[model samples]
Target: MTTPPPNQNDIQNGAGSSPPRQQTVALVDDDRNILTAVSIGLQAEGFATRVYADGETALKALLENPPDLAIFDIKMPRMDGLQLLQSLRAQSALPVIILTSKDEEPDEALGLALGADDYITKPFSQRLLVARIRAILRRSELVRNPPEDAPGDEQAGTIGRGRLRLDPARHQVTWNDRSVSLTVTEFLILEALAMRPGVVKSRNQLMDAAYNDDVFVDDRTIDSHIKRLRRKFRSVDPEFAAIETLYGAGYSFADG
Candidate 1:
């Protein structure tokens, strides 16, 4: 059970984990039910929860203190989730999963385009939410601390394809020597494509590379991520076209 503080705004809920390194998840939603239910749900999975009544409060605290991950509801007063996401993307690459009450593709597409790692519709299952948080956290951790034998040096474990460089250990990518921030999902997807330059990777294959077996994402999700990836690369280099789409097939990478 996650017990909110006296005021509860921008504050951590539940008992503190001074022993193990517990990841904290910030929930920004106008709905009290969602805040309370999701808080307890995340606590049950050994994660600390921070509940915000709206996106405005969450954005301020998130930028100052930050969290392991954040879930933002699309509709909110003071500031909406998409606005918060867009504002946050201007400063941080914090892993974010947006919650949308509407079952519209446009919302999902816009969120993804604005640097959200994932999006979930309202009335989502607690198990699925917890699963997504864990999956993204795991990837984030791997990027921070790669295995000893995983090519950690300057020249090792880094895949260089012409002007693009993929560093699996750091979960980083660069185009034309300029840095490009990508979400955990985007980084993994790009890594998959860069690892095998000419070989096309289907949406299913990409979903496998980035996500765990328990969590599932569809083809459109992959497509959205790909679009964002291109947008990000193009931000650094306008002529960026390494990511190729083969109609009726899949996507491949070719830096040249």
Candidate 2:
């Protein structure tokens, strides 16, 4: 006789073979059509999704049951994307990607300044969205589980330049012995700079180092990240001046 398929519990317990648990993504948007379409696309790609119609609701649910990643729409009612981003940043460093409409460059810049990891304008391709999500998640995973045989696989796994200390394995940064919190993107950007002190890296070079090639990031995005990076370091040490800009060129990390 033919055997029946394994039940959910049996599959989960490995009594029968099954794919690993799918990562969950929280999709926040007031547009029902967009929400449904994106949710379907994400689910098709082996991702479980939680959908919300407004920012306030999404924020509550997200904090209560955090997901692997989140996507927010800039024009949501009750609580817009920027406000939700602000609330989320206050408590967690959950990787976030914001959605904006065409001609909303200012909004995009503001979102990035407020700690958004990335932003995509409206009318974006679904495939493009998926690619962006995967890129961010990939970075997050790397930060969580660094390579066992990383170039510097020491007990501390830390890199230092002057007063700045970076621990790639721990995904931590310290300045003058004090801890400083940085978003995954910010950490990557700073790491690239600190890796080669006094070496000016062009915007394209920094972008290549920080993000996957599939995701298209403009020069302003890099500039915004640099600005936030400096702001964060300055907050910890008022006289922080390690990052320097070269007009008509790019940026370099001072060895001081």
Query: Quick one: best TM-score, which candidate?
Result: 1
Taking all chains together, the TM-score of candidate 1 against the true structure is 0.78
Q: Tell me the lDDT of model 2 at 22.
A: 59
Ten consecutive residues with minimal summed lDDT in candidate 1?
5-14
The positional error of residue 185 in candidate 1, measured at the CA in angstroms, is: 1.6
Tens digit of per-residue lDDT, candidate 1, span 75-180: 8999999999999987788899988765665777677667687788878899889878887887787554556676553667688899988887777788888999
Residues 1-256, model 2: lDDT tens digits: 2232221111112224324645778888877777767776776677777778888878877888888889999998899999999899877778999999889888877887787888888898889988888888877865545667666625666888889999877787899998887888889889999999999999999888876665566788899889878878888899999999999799999987
lDDT of the structure predicted as candidate 1: 0.80
| Candidate 1: regions farther than 4 A off | 1-17, 102-106, 143-151, 154-156, 211-223
TM-score of each: 0.78, 0.78
Overlapping backbone residue pairs in candidate 1 total: 0
Off by over 4 Å in 2: 1-21, 144-157, 212-220
